[model samples]
Target: MSRSYRTVHIRDFHDDDLDGIVVLWEAVHNAVIRPVYSLAEVIASCQEDHAVVAVDGDQVVGAAVGRAAHAQGWVVFFGVSAADADGQIAADLLDALERRMAPLGLAKLSVLVAEHDGRVAALAGNGFGMRHTLRYLERPMPVQRRELDVLGDVGGRILPRHLWEAVAGMSAEKRLLEERLVTPLAHPELAERFGVMPPRAVMLFGPPGTGKTTFAKAVASRLGWPFVELFPSRLGDTAGGMAAALRATFERIGSLEHAVVFIDEVEEIASRRRGDPPSPTQGVTNELLKLVADFRDGSGRLLICATNFVRALDAAFLRHGRFDYVIPIGLPDAAARAAIWGRYVPASVDIDLADLVDRSDGLTPADIEYAARRASQEALARALRTDGGDAEPLGLADYVDALAATRATVSDESARDFLADIEAYGRL
Candidate 1:
C-alpha cells in the first residue's frame, strides 16, 4: 500500500505549519485549475481566520480555511496533496473546518471553485451544493485580517483612499514625491528594469504644521499600506524605557508584510549626540540609527521621519546611505494655496478664490484648515442668534476675518531656518 494509507490526523493549524501548508498549496496550484483565492489571502486567513490541517506524521497532507460572514460561512481555501488521491482527507478537512465555524450560527456554507477544479466531488460529498446561477466577484481589501491585530498593537491604521487625492495643492512637492517615491515603490517590476531601488527611508524637514504628517499619511493611503506612527514621547511609557521600547516596536513592525512607519518630531529622540556630558538622548539616538540600518535591509516597508528642526539631528544620522532622500517640505505657494482654499470653501458660497489664495501666502495647510473651520463655526454662531430667515451664511469676509485671526505656525525666523537647512542638508 502507498504511504497515503497511513493514519492522518486533522487538527487546528499551528503557526509553524504554515510552511507545510504552503507546500500543499503549491502542489495543487501546479496542477490543473488555480486556487480561487490568492496565496496572500489564504495565508492571512490561516493565521487570523479559521483553518484546519490534515497531518500525516509531520507532513501536511491537506488543509482547509474558512471565514464567517454573518449567516454565511465561506470556504476560503481547500486543498489536499496528491497522496490523498482517495479524497477522504479532503472530506475530513472540510468537516473539521465546518465544526470549527459551527458556533458562528452560519445558515449556509459555500465556496467558489475555478472551473473544472478536481475538488468538486469532495465538496459535494461534504454537503456543499453547486450554485450554478450565482456568480462570485471580489474587490481586494486594503488591510488583511492577519495584520489587524498587529496594526492595532502598533497604533496603525489604513487611511482612506481619498486622502491622496484630497491633498489640496503642494503640486511641486506632490510631483517630486510621485516621481521619487510613489512611482518606484508602486511599480517595483518597472523600477527594477531601470535599475532603481525604491526608497526605504526618507526625512521630511520643514517649518511646523507644513503638512509633513499629512503627506506621510497620504503616501500610505496611496500605496494601500498600513500607516504606523511611532511617537517618541509615548515610547518612554513602556517598562523597557525609550530605547528598549523602540527596538520592540520595530520588531512588531517587522511582522507586517508592508507598512509606512512615521515618526513625527523625530528630532526629540535623534537630536545631536554629544559626549561632553553625554546627552540624555544619546542612547536613544544610537538605537534609532541602528534601527534605520536594519529597516533598510527589509523590503516592502518605508520609514518616514519628520522634523521641524533639521539641524538638530545628529550629523551621523543624516550621512549618506542612512536616508534614501532628505526632502524638504516648505509652506504653500500661490497655486497650492488656491487649491487648499477650494477644499474648505463650500460650493454654494461665492468667495474670491484668487483674493483668499493671494492673502494666505505664508500660511501652512493646517493653518488654512483651521481658519476655514473657524469661519464656518463663527458663521453658524451668528446665524443661531438671529432669526433663521435671511441669516447671512459663510462668505469671503468671514474667511478673511478668520485668516486675520489665525496665526501662522511658521514664522519668518523659522522659515529662514528651513530654507537654510534645505540648502545645507537637502539630498533630493
Candidate 2:
C-alpha cells in the first residue's frame, strides 16, 4: 500500500538523510529515466554543496542539491518519492535550495536532465523553460596536482567561503578594506582601466587583541586564495639561521600560483636596529625587507603583516614602495560591541543588550567573548548549587557579574596611544 502524509516540511539536508536519498535515487533509476548526475556525484553534492530536503516527520521525501561555479548555479540533484510525485515537495525543495544559494550572487540557475525524464513537468511547473540542448562537459579542477603539493609544503590552506560576511561589525574597517584591498584585487581589469594598481603588501597595526589577524584571514577568504602564515619563531627551527630560514621560506612560497602570506607580531623581527654591534634580528629584518620588495614584483599574491606596537618597527620599513597601506585596527566601537555581544549571547537568555554594550565600551572583541563565556560558566555553577533544581535562564545579573570580574585587555592609556599612532603613522 502507498503511504500518504498529512503534511510535508522542507528543511536543510542532514547527514542522516543519506539512506532516504539513496532510496529515492534508486526509485528514479528503476523508472526508466536516469538522472544526469551519477549517484556518487549527487551524494558528494549533498554533503559538500548546497542542498535542501522535504521531510514528513522522520522520513525524507524529497531533496534538491546545487553547486555554484563562478556566476552560474547548477542543480546537481532533484528528486521526490513516488508517492509525492504530483505533490509540491519537489518545488519546495528547489525553492529552499535556491534561497540557500541566493547570497552567492549567481546570475542564473540551470539543470540537466535525461531527454525522456518523467519529472520534466514538475520543473516546468516551477518556471523552468527548455533551453538549447548541449552536451555536458567535464574537466579537472583549476588547482593542479603540483599546486596542491606546493600548498602543503608551505603550510597554506584555503579558508572557508563567506568569511567576509561572517565578520560581524566594524563597518568602517570593513568598508575601507573592501574598497582599498578587495575591490582592486578582485577586479584587477576594472581597476586597471582607471589607472589603479592592486596593492601588493599592507600592514595592520593596533593594540593586542584588536583582531588584526582575523581581518587578514577574512581577506584571504574573501579572495578565494590559499592562506599561508609565516611564523618568525618557527623560522629558527631549521638548520640555517633565522635569516637564511626566512629566505628559504620565501623561495618556496614563490613557487605557488597564488597565496595570501601573513606574518603576525612582525615587531619581533622588524624592530628598530640599535647599539654598536647591531642586534641579532637586524640580519632577519634586512632579509625580510628584501623579501617584501621581491614578493611585490609578482602577481596574484598579497602580503599582510600585523603588529601590536607599530612604533617599534624599523623606520625604513615604513617607507613608501614597501607597504601600500598602514591601517589601524582599534578596539571595538559601539556598534561593533553590540554585534560581538549578540554573537555570544544565547537566544534563550533575557538580558538587556544595550546595557551590556554600554558596559563593554572600550573592550576588544576578544574581551567581550571572554566575558560572555565567563557568564555562562557562572550561570551553570549557580544552577548546580541551588536546591530543588531551581533552574532559570541566564539573566543580566550573570553577565554584569562576569563583566565586573573580567579584566579589560586594552587600557585607557593604551587606547590613547593607539589614537596617537593612528595620527602619526596611519596610511591608507
How many pairs of residues collide in each model?
0, 0
Point to the candidate with the largest TM-score. 1
Q: Number of the top candidate by lDDT?
A: 1
What's the true lDDT of residue 76 in model 2?
88
TM-score (C-alpha) between model 2 and the true structure? 0.69
User: What lDDT would each prediction earn against the true structure?
Assistant: 0.89, 0.87
Error of 1 at 415 (Å): 2.6
Q: Which portions of model 2 miss their true places by more than 4 Å?
A: 1-143
Put down candidate 2 lDDT per residue, 134-209, tens digits, no spaces: 7667632434568898788878888886889878788999999998898899899989999989999999999999
Query: Model 1: per-residue lDDT, tens digit, 374-410?
Result: 9999999999889776688899889989999999998
